[model samples]
Target: MRSTTEQTVQPCPQCGTEIRTDRRFTTWCSACDWNVDPVEPDERPGRVERMRRGIAHRYGERLLAEMTGGESRRPRRDVAGVLACTVALCVHGVTVALLLAGVLLVTLGWGGALPVLGAFLLGLAWLLRPRFGRLPDDAPVLHRADAPRLFALIDEVAACAPTSGVHAVAVTAEVNASVSTYGIGQRRLLTLGLGLWEITAPQERVALLGHELGHFAHGDTRHGVIIANALHSLNSWRYLVAPIRNPSGLEVILNALYLLPFLAVQGVMMLLDQLTLRAAQRAEYLADASSATAASTEAAVALQDRLLVYGSAETFLLRESNARQVRDRAKRDEPEQGLWDRLAAYVESIPESEYERRRRVGALRGHSVDSTHPPTHLRRACLLAGPAEPAAVRVDAEAVAAITAELADARRVVARRVLRG
Candidate 1:
């Protein structure tokens, strides 16, 4: 006689729904939208494939949205705008201070103008100085035995454009890579994080390195530093004026005489910083396009996807931690009190809710006047919509040679300036 047997049932990995089956392979859970396939894993396409799809599908749509809304790609300003704003703000500030001092001088003496002029000159010098002293070429190098494959891929992409030769490359455990220019001649430095290396495909890695090269080729390093310096000065002036604008009774009495000039200076600087921020946003778009053109559209998409995933993960984790903290606080016990007293005390003691916390995080990430880089979503969109032609590729040997020669000359010029100082 044959005996009847019962088989065990497992839940679907994708959606968490229970499944009564004898099948050995399971990939999706219908209930919770999870992937349970241990061998196959989740998202079989890898980083590059996912990015390519995202660029093809979502990049154009997002770009259109931002363009129609008149939003900037990045939070920082371009070099020209930064310079214009810095000069305008400084000039206006000096003019106002002088005008106020002139009135005082008429009543008293003529010695105050000299100090005011000296202060103005000092502010100008500070704003004009290069903020990035030297490139990260001097950063310690990390060499792992597994770096050969990654290096080979980078070499292939660099060979595609002669001017794209990397000046320095280093590996770190961080999940990001950055390209920067330092000193005179704008020596390039490329940094890659181990996290990025582990997750990114060969093509995706090439695209990232290519993006850094694009920044170098477009003179973004020098321009970015100039803009950053100008912004820093603007911020400093803003802080200096805040106390004067909203002074205490005693402070107000002391500053009452110079209030007009202080207000004028603050207003001028604020306007300049806003304009500079606008210009920087435009430059970010240009750089994104340069990167896309250097590589293929697919590669650009892949790079953007990787950035978005990393950025989103960071944002989500922060939000989750804040939420957990709130939950923990709410569980604390409290003594009973009168109705109005309890109400007031409860309202005052309540921490930020999850929604409020998330909103704040979004706001910080969405719009940043102080940041030197653009928002991740906007940067990705720009790359997707960038030029299809490979015009940004610097594959010409002569051109690379010229850039190298020019870099050497720039170094000499900077050295001379330093010596003179």
Candidate 2:
């Protein structure tokens, strides 16, 4: 209901320091970071999240040590990778066995409940079948004709990384970017998040591209269809076998029947996670190295610094959306033009000291983009510790301008989606 710029100053009860409080955001003491990120009841992590956090902290430290201790920078296959692949193969084998058993029962068993049992087995087989990754039908896609300048930039990064290029590029409203394969053909796709792209400097954008492409270069096991689908199947199996909290007579029997299977699936999932965790971490470090190789160590580290403040960027977007809602309710005029411009200005206004503080906070909390990756602070340190290579693919201001123009329509659509929330 009020301008985001309108703020009041008050003393932080914790530290007795003056802190600016914006009406649209939490009132937090920047000096002491009081209430900066208050823990809400719902924000408390579940058992699985706690386990993942522990794993992240443990392996994050180990990988950081290995990288900084003059260990080979290149990613190599180890026992963990082999075990992970074997586990995935076994999972697939089980699915095939289910299919064959279902077929045999249906063909050979001609009486009693055998037909129904065979059908049940067939259903299980279908559920456990390996899933081929697919692109989201709703997300906007940019082909070479649609965004030649952008594709040129991606191609440049691909060449620099010496990785096979993507077949298509997809854009989304997320505050992240990633690369993955899709379809039976296993065509590579690059997903560029406008939220992140709008704030990145040209060289930083190159670094981002280089980093995602690096995953392909390093053969990130987690991204492979076999492993990815196995993980998916395991999760699905867990969900299917999970015990119901509230069960009636027959349902109670069903729930009791599911308990053993639920525990078994959980154990298998945990084993798969443990086996693959080290290789996944190594893949990330190698990707970061590739990023530094293509976009320079400075830009790679800068990209990580930008990642630390994505929460702030998301907050800014929320505030803007709320402000727009208030204006609409009051029948006050406010055009939604230049949303990306406003976002860029807001991020650019952040002081370097603020970034440093967030980095420290990330380290304190072992925060990462996701549980799969190391802490952002550790990734930044790894990049900084490596050689400061120059950029292999540079996107100049003119190229950036061209690419921005090409993405103009997509930006408007994404901005509308964000504001609508």
Candidate 3:
């Protein structure tokens, strides 16, 4: 670790990398791995860093033991998140109750002076209730019948992880994989990315699946979805109360009734959202360890490394270049192998520093209070330090062979879908 406080950085003579003078000898250039010497382990991680890493590793170890026939346990729920949803629901309930009471008594008893207002409030409350439905998805779903090998892989991962199983599965063109809940009832959906499959080895693919399954192991989304939906509802009203259109005198007065209290409550909801994010971060750390336990440490670490590379600017450039090639060659009789070759070549040419930037940015895994996951660096540190726990099972070579072939087809299928878009 180097002192990042100093803003001035001089260029490395060989690699043209920016470097602070104090760290020049100890810190390597990420692009070229250029340095005077390797940093000693003791000097790198201080006491507080060691404690956090150790705790994360311990959580992973417990989850790994559970996967190995120990009793299945529920990860703690996010109380703050539930409370946020409760507050949101209470707002809707109170508004509805007041509307009903007003319409039945005030409007009727006051000679119909406020009948129109009461009716309007009733409609507004209906419009603002938490619409407990999943958003529509355009990505193509992969059925077990259509892709047995893929399904087999999914099923195997599901059995090993601490989840009941996903409700649906699909593949996409992105370089990432995710497991999410959809619809009003919180059904699960698993999404696999073709780009990751194209680059990953069989073992690495297992690591990736294990990570998504890990999210389910902790019920990260199903529980957090409430807080998310609550925030979405509140934010929706926040904007709804804004002067989106010119207000009539009567509308202005009604808006004041709704807007003032909503603004005050909206600030409180934001605070709760951050408070509830802690559970998500814990889920992520344990899940990272789960990935390592399911796959080998080697495979898990490799998959994580590739993820960093996947986020780098170089990857974006490579993807666009490949896509442009695909479009250009759409009508060509040229071999498809050439396109794959070109893509591999471009990615191999990128400097290591581009990937390092992803690590420095902490990728999507940072432990920011607002984020659900710990940084990829922290997760990896914990995992690498853990006591040995070999993978429970490796799919037989024949099954691995079958799935590997299916993986290739998946890449083509996803690319074609992207092409259509």
Root-mean-square deviation (CA) per prediction: 18.0, 3.8, 9.4
Number of the predicted model whose lDDT against the real structure is largest? 2
lDDT of 3 by residue, 203-318 (tens): 78888888888887866642555555656656666666654357798878877777776666566545554445455555666677667778877778877777765643235435
- Give the distance in Å from residue 50's predicted Cα in candidate 1 to where it truly belongs: 33
**Candidate 3 at 37: error in angstroms?**
22
Q: After superposition, how far is residue 350 of candidate 3 from its true place, in Å?
A: 4.2
lDDT of each prediction vs. the true structure?
0.47, 0.82, 0.60
Model 2 pairs in collision: none
Candidate 1 C-alpha error for residue 21, in Å? 22
Choose the strongest candidate by TM-score. 2
TM-score per model over all chains: 0.46, 0.88, 0.67
After superposition, candidate 2 runs with Cα above 4 Å error: 1-41, 246-252, 322-336, 367-369
10 residues in a row with least lDDT, candidate 2: 327-336
Query: What is candidate 3's local distance difference test score?
Result: 0.60
Ranking by lDDT: 2, 3, 1
